[model samples]
Target: MTDTTPADELRTAAQTLLDLADDTAEDMATNDYWRSAVVEPKHWFHNGIDNAVGGPAGKLAGLMSPRFARMLAIYFRDEAGRGQDFDTRAVTLARVMNGGQP
Candidate 1:
């Protein structure tokens, strides 16, 4: 029997979402609806799926792995959760991003 943890499951699910998004990737240049929507990102955000980061973005690749997801969530969820400030949180997040290699 294989042992798969919840993080592993979430990772798989994230991958599936990325794959599905790729499968249905539409060229914004040729997509009038999408093009018009992005023209006023904040306005469209009030409608649905506010996934934009800076302005108009998609496919959250940073959540590619469970570890990455956890690290990011920790930093964003609450800096006070661990009694760490912004700099500390940034350091912690950076360490995880480096994969603890060195």
Candidate 2:
């Protein structure tokens, strides 16, 4: 058998979600909140997928992975409901990617 770590699982799940999003919806524009949301561990798979398609910082690939694009939509929903702060959101993502508080 093969070994599948939580990170790998997360990546796969993330990729799937992003693909679904691209298939069903429109692309997400980069904004302060989106920038913040993109960094969380929960969203890290999107982060990687985004990078694979050229993230916000690089080029505008236009949801190269639909699943990741959709996962981003869900995050936006939560962010909207909670009225999350851009800085706070960004920090969460930072923590997820950097392995500690940002």
Candidate 3:
């Protein structure tokens, strides 16, 4: 059995979500309906995140992981294009969570 800390679990969960977002973005990029319906209305993703997460920062916090939450907060607060491509944002967050420069 391998022992993993809570932080480790959080990081793994975050990475999984980020990868999903990246895949969704990749698919959306090629779909005209998504482009017009989602991309065009900049707030669509933001609203969805906010709603799904239960607040602007709720999603990360709701993860029940402090370290991951902090990383996400910092990313959302300081990163550019918060309302743009989700794949890019997810990748950026994943990099930071992994201790890489985003």
Q: Compare the candidates by lDDT and give the number of the best one.
A: 3
TM-score on alpha carbons, each prediction = 0.29, 0.28, 0.39
Which parts of model 2 are misplaced by more than 4 Å? Answer: 26-102
Model 3 Cα shift for residue 94 (angstroms): 13
Give the runs in model 3 whose Cα sits over 4 Å from its true position: 37-39, 44-102
TM-score quality measure for candidate 2 = 0.28
Writing each residue's lDDT as its tens digit, candidate 1 over 23-102 gives 43333324444444344633332222334433343234323333444444444434323332334434444444434321
Model 2 C-alpha lDDT per residue in residues 23-92, reported as the tens digit of each score? 4333334333334443653454356545656647434443344555555545544443443343355335
Worst 10 residues of 1 by lDDT: 41-50
> What do the candidate models score in CA lDDT, each in turn?
0.39, 0.46, 0.49
Model 1 C-alpha lDDT versus the unseen true structure: 0.39
Quote the RMSD, in angstroms, for model 3: 12.3
lDDT of 1 at 77: 37
Q: What is the lDDT of residue 95 in candidate 1?
A: 41
Using alpha carbons, what is the TM-score of model 3? 0.39
